[model samples]
Target: MKPDIHPVSRPVVFRDRAAGVAFLTRSTAHSTRTIEWEDGAVHPLVDVEISSASHPFHTGTSRVLDTAGRVERFERRYGRTAPNRR
Candidate 1:
């Protein structure tokens, strides 16, 4: 272990804007914003676009891409440019 060479791990709040959820955890990440936590203490606030609260996998709202429809449309427009094997 080295002195004065490691990041400080402290209690910080991560806010998921989309999910409207905030959680406190120990992290080495830093932030310029401040937020008043539920315990009435001010902590460093980090804004995140997505987290476990709003993620597709965690929320079970995953989106399926329309690749088959896209392939059909491409073939209709380009007349099957790929060669077929016997």
Candidate 2:
């Protein structure tokens, strides 16, 4: 209810570098950079590394870590150390 204390909610552009996609939506976040949208409206620009466009699961390109390889390397160094052995 206070002026200047409330978050500014306005239209913003989120840019995804990897997927080369730009999205326009409303947000309360602030930014110093600005750009013109496709509709010829100037708005704050937010650069993001990943989004729905480039996200692995979203794009059906998810990658799994090789935990088996890591465990083998670790055991080679520690001689396959056992935990809580009686």
Candidate 3:
């Protein structure tokens, strides 16, 4: 409830280059680039490498890591050791 302390929030356009999608929202982040939104208004354009549109988890394209294979590889590289008995 403080006054003159919060950063200004303005309409900004976040463009996801990989997914080729643009979203209009309010944010404190600033950018030198500008984009004309569908509403015929210019908004600061921020380019992001990845967003929900293209992220593996969000897109359901995430790969399950091969932990078993990794363990085997590590053991091969450094011979497996016997359990340390206290």
Candidate 4:
């Protein structure tokens, strides 16, 4: 463990603009903006478009696509049948 090799991990607030969610975590990332946290402490704030709260996958709003089913349906309609493995 060298003194100069380690990066600082301080509390940073990542705010999701659309979802209105704020995350408090330690990161090396720094910003000029600051905000008062829920605990009455000020921390560096980073504005983000999407976060775990707003992201489709994390929020369970992601669209599930059936690739195999869609391909079969397309082949049947377009009349381009693939070779049967059987």
Candidate 5:
């Protein structure tokens, strides 16, 4: 380990604006904004537009693409042809 070479790591609050969720975690990221946490302590506030709470994948709201249907449509538009297996 080297002295005076490592970046400072501290607690930071990442707030999901859309989901209105905030969590405190240790990060090297710095922010000028601050917010009062649940523990009555103010930490660096980082505002984010998306997080696991509001993301479509995490929320199970993501749309599944119909690849099979798309292939059928393509075949209907243009007749299927054998692929070069060589």
Candidate 6:
């Protein structure tokens, strides 16, 4: 281990505004904003647009694309041709 070589990690508050959820975790990320946590401590606040709480995949709301159907449509539009041999 080296001395004073690692970036400082401190408690940071990641706020997911879309999900209205805030959690405290240690990170090297910095923010100009501050937030008062549930423990009555102030931590650097980072606003995130999406998180596991609000993400489509995490929330089980993501759509499964019909790749086979898309391939069929593309073949219909542009007739499927035989592979060219060298």
Best by lDDT: 3
lDDT of 4: 0.93
Between prediction 5 and prediction 6, which has the larger lDDT? 6
**Each model's total of backbone clashes:** 0, 0, 0, 0, 0, 0
Off by over 4 Å in 4: 81-86
Cα RMSD (Å) per model? 3.2, 3.3, 2.4, 3.2, 2.2, 1.7
**Local distance difference test, each candidate:** 0.95, 0.92, 0.97, 0.93, 0.95, 0.96
Query: What's the CA error at residue 76 for candidate 4, in Å?
Result: 2.0
Task: Give TM per candidate.
Answer: 0.75, 0.70, 0.81, 0.81, 0.84, 0.84
Q: Whose TM-score is higher: candidate 1's or candidate 4's?
A: 4
- Over 20-74, each residue of candidate 1 has an lDDT whose tens digit, in order, gives 9999999988899999999999999999999999999999999899999999999
> Which digits, one per residue and each the tens of the lDDT, describe model 3 over residues 1-86?
99999999999999999999999999999899999999899999999999999999999999999999999999999999999999
lDDT of 5 by residue, 1-86 (tens): 98999999999999999999987999999899999988999899999999999999999999999999999999999989999898
Q: After superposition, which runs of candidate 2 have C-alpha atoms over 4 Å from their true positions?
A: 1-5, 65-83
The sequence of per-residue lDDT tens digits that candidate 2 reaches over residues 1-86 is 77899787899999999999999999987889999998998999999999999999999899899999999999898886557857
In model 1, what is the error at residue 50, expressed in angstroms?
1.6
Checking candidate 5 for backbone clashes, the offending pairs are: none
Best model per TM-score: 5
What order do you get sorting by lDDT, best first?
3, 6, 5, 1, 4, 2
Worst 10 residues of 5 by lDDT: 21-30
- Stretches of candidate 1 off by over 4 Å are 76-78, 82-86
* Pairs of colliding residues, candidate 6: none
Per-residue lDDT tens digits for candidate 6, residues 1-86, read: 98999999999999999999988999999899998999899999999999999999999999999999999999999999899999
